[model samples]
Target: MSDINVNHILNQMRSLSLQAAGKPVQETGGSTDFSSLLQQSLASVNETQQRAGRMVDAFESGASNISLAEVMVESQKANVSFQATLQVRNKLVEAYKDVMNMPM
Candidate 1:
């Protein structure tokens, strides 16, 4: 087996991440609310997960067009997004606890 370029993979992942977020690299200076941003991000993650699942199914059924590396990269993207979402949830919970514990 030949070595895959780590940099290339990372760049591709980053590109997909930006596209998935549904935001341009340069913000238009328009104010975005936390709720909307969060919603958009969650939607993106869900979409990524769904796409990966489909890719896995296709590959498993002996899809000639789907390559193993493509499936793997898609799977990794889903995992990374999920992990980030989990961390965000954890922090939000911690913040709530901290606020509740603060002296009145």
Candidate 2:
């Protein structure tokens, strides 16, 4: 899928979460809440992880006739998504630490 499609999915997830939480939709918004953004990112990462797991299982179980190349591509996609999630988590933690250290 295109990068725009991925971004669209993320935005939809964020909007759903905000609506569920009874928060006003941020129209003409200055900025989004970092924590909500991170949560949506994590959700997407989890989806990728699950898809990878399924691909591996299919390869091992002889249930799917999918090619090795397809399996490998799915695995790589999961790996890259996981690494991206890790980086986002690290940055969020660092930002939190900085905020905590600041004088109130």
Each prediction's whole-model lDDT (CA): 0.84, 0.77
Clashing pairs in 2: none
Off by over 4 Å in 2: 1-35
Per-residue CA lDDT of model 1 for 45-91, tens digit only, reads 89989999999999999999999999999999999999999999999
Cα lDDT tens digits for candidate 2, 21-71: 466766523355767766766787788789888988888888668778888
What are the clashing pairs of model 1? none
Give the number of the best model, judged by lDDT: 1
Alpha-carbon deviation at 83 in model 1, angstroms: 0.2
**How does model 2 score by TM-score?**
0.62
